[model samples]
Target: RRLKKKHFVIECDPLVHEGFESTARHVEIPYLPMLVPPTKWKGYDKGGHLFLPSYVMRTHGVKDQKEAIKSVPRKQLRKVFEALDILGGTKWRVNRRVHDVVETIWSRGGGIAGLVDKGNIPLPEQPETEDPDEIQKWKWSVKKTKKANRELHAERCDTELKLSVARKMREEDGFYYPHNLDFRGRAYPMHPHLSHLGSDLCRGVLEYAEGRPLGKSGLRWLKIHLANKYGGGIEKLSHESKLTFVEDHLPDIFDSAANPVDGNCWWINAEDPFQCLAACMDLSNALESSSPHGAVSHLPIHQDGSCNGLQHYAALGRDYMGAAAVNLVPGEKPADIYSEIAARVLDVVREDSMKDPATDPSVPLAKVLVDEVSLLPAPLCLNQEIFFFMYLFFNKTVEDLDIGSLQVDRKLVKQTVMTSVYGVTFIGARQQIMKRLQEKGHITDDKLLYDVSCYATRVTLDALGQMFQSARAIMAWLGDCAKMIASKNQPVRWTSPVGLPVVQPYKKYKNYMIRTSLQCLALRREGDAIATQRQKAAFPPNFVHSLDSSHMMMTAITCKEAGLHFAGVHDSFWVHACDVDKMNQILREQFVELYSMPILENLLEEFQTLFPTVEFPPCPAQGNFDVREVLTSTYFFN
Candidate 1:
């Protein structure tokens, strides 16, 4: 006997299919008459096979099933009242409950996994393959290992050798030395007999041999060398190792904002390799020690924690401040070490940026990137607006954009997305682009337009795939173009080491000024006397003022008082100084007094086009010119 399959039909009307089968057939029938096919319709005497009884046929006495079925509409049209009732009642409410449940889960981070079972997910498992033959053929080999511990005398000898070599290198060459002799993997320390120079210089030489830049490469190499007997290659280095390298090279790589590089904002220990070297040299010079070794040997123990490498490029004063916090003795006054370190580090970087590098003729831009990569330390978390602006600054010319004069109309978008500070800024990527553009003297804020131009350039270059090997070639071409534009007065040609210089037609415009000046001079000399005099008179002045008022003003407000103070003797002032105290005080006062009545009125008027309805109370024209009262009132109202 076949197992019975369960089925239930929900009826639209209770009377529709009622009594279709006779009592005898309902009790036990071979098949249900209602479900029988058309061929078996003859067998179903009452209920027609594949067709139900129609109400129209019952009323009109229509005999044929086909004709009866044709009389009824295929799609039933609901009465207006029924439709209205459904709309007004629970049908929508039930659906809304379902939607709410869906929304709740979606808002709570619901994903595809919730609706799926592991078996139904269509995941295919690979068939296991075993290679018994290969396993049997595999051979195991034993290698001899040595475990020799250095005796006390040997260890002492090694340390003495390392220290001596470090001292010798410091004296002979103007190179830095490492503080320790312990190698990373090797049990034996580097022999003093092999290297007379200090550890840091040796590390630099090793790095140079490894085909890397002199900046972070040396530090990274040292770290790796310390970690292993045979140092790992750059590609093979671990992620943590790379970060450690960045930390080590931070100060040298990111010396200033202008020279921003990877790991620029990181804080590390005080006595780093770079600082140690500089400190040693400074101490040597100050003590009038004849030899570097003698100086190093006679130097006092570092009472304060040593300078960290990261501290070398940044404000050492900051490092010293932090160190003082940690190094404080009970009831001891905070040492003035911060000021000293700040002075030293500032002096070092200042002189360094001014120095010309051996690689190129370009002037170092008053700052050195402490790190090789500017955005290396997770640069992706930068603000979108900053990134966008930086992108434009990098890729486009400032002359093409009047962004400073342009105003953003909407308050919300302006504050949240477009403005500086709170606005979204992509730090690393923007920095990369901005630095590139600033090098070309194009620093403007029309970021989107610049991005569009960059996109166009990329698309154009992509089209030129057959002409160029890479996009870098296009950039190199642009760099050359920029050079020509900058040096229009000077003519420069690319020259081979042993071959004659070749003139490039692409760079012919480089002699623009010379050619124009010579042509004008010749015309003046050769033209008729009257024409020459007229030409001379027609020549424009040598210097015309810049179009922008901000730049042309020659002076700017650098300081201000705050909080409704009546002006007595002092007005707001501006001064250029490297000191922090005056600047900080001015900033504090400005922040406090921004809403003074007169200033508020000026601001309201200035921004009237952008923010109307803002008003300012008038300042007293009486004794001491009560600017503070106006400012305070404006502040209170606003």
Candidate 2:
């Protein structure tokens, strides 16, 4: 009663089968998901409009809407949410010409050229060695070479992906990237690549979708923006002086605009080459117009902070000297903190070198020829034979230290000074200096470079401590508070000025194995015990970051209400050239308003209320600097 079924088996030729099997063996299998979709699940009302409360609740992943509303006060949430929406809604388009240039550079692997210039040498061939020590050294070299190559490849892939997406978006009228906040309430574009957050090439290839007439003020600002990108001694000049510098370079700018790759390549030498090139093009277009003031422009002029973290610290402590150093108050020229630190470090080195080695126990001594040679005391153990030869050839004597031979400049000490507020360790500072020294192609000897980096790091930190005494006191107080809370097995928690709750997530974690169909997976479970050291060390920087975010959010909201197109990258703010003045006024106003509140006092009060049993130190006393002075301080945001 059952029907018979027929089966067919098909076989290919033996040669074909062999070829297919070989190809299959060489192909890589992707075990993980290759691509992720953008998050677009925003909350909408019955009329399909964005609902602030609903969106916040969904983003925070709170099932109870009422509870979410209670955590973030409704009024504060609305302001932040609206600001984010405004930021996301601003449309952008790619500069087709610049995009093409970027594509050409990427095709030739130009992205990794800087790494090569920084002493990332080519991979070496494997050596046939029987000695175990030699083999071990060769293995280390191979590993380092592989790492550099992998990094270079990764950078290339990232650039290509960005360019591909940009090419696709260029055909459309315009594209908008949605924005969201981190745990600390810092807003960022949700889309990873091809956003304003990328490098100089990315910024150069992007412009506002909408264009406004470049009136007289806008044109002046455009020229200043160009000069700013060029970045040299001219950067510290006043606005009028900057404009004059641009005027003087009119011929070079035009040449760069007309022939980016072939001409003199004047823009190529700028601090931000691609952006500077874009500015040159914008300037050319404006000038070629019969009515230069009436030319349409879409560039966003930037006003960056001068070491913004230190600025906030200075503001919080009301330290006038610190404020002036960071350019939070008025100055004839914009203060250069890095250069000032470099000068202080140089003075310290010279003073130390001038001490008589025989008389002063602190002074370091080294024997050298008496032919008027300036010698830096070597910190290494030199061979006795070499010392004896030097003494025999020339009388042993100490000479003036040739400070000029040492390359201690603003660039050398910039990173150390910048990260000092973030609690960079001594080892970390030394490593930063070492990399800078290597890039400069001075001190090729590994041991000598290490010694110099160690010395420089010490003086750099000492200089920072001396310069920002109030900042140090505040940092110590913050660390102490975190230590106290973390010692009690609780994470430090606080509410930002904008009412966003921030919790330190650093805690001890335990690993567990989970059995899956394919294999066993190890996952980490966050434990109750706090990571006391990390919690203590990270609090100062994290707290400062949250405060800066609050300042930015306040500025964003105010700028939006004032009907100005606005964008921000942490401390740096941007608006159209025409709206720069208005945006500056609003930013200054919001800054003063944000700091007017008793920030540290409120934080201490919150901690006291949250942990009644834990006794905490009182807030540091405020200094005499006036917050209102920022309003008239032209260089505050420059």
- Candidate 2 lDDT over 244-361, as tens digits, reads 6688779999998888766888887777777888889998999998999999888888988788899889999999999999888886667778767866776677677677987854
> Model 1: which ten-residue window has the lowest total lDDT?
540-549
Write candidate 1's Cα lDDT for 183-278 as tens digits.
010011112231212232222111100111112222322222222211112112242443454344434333311121122311112112222232
Model 2 regions lying over 4 Å from their true place: 1-70, 108-122, 125-141, 356-406, 513-522
Q: What is the C-alpha RMSD of each candidate to the true structure, in Å?
A: 42.1, 11.3
Give lDDT for model 1. Answer: 0.23
The candidate scoring highest on TM-score is: 2
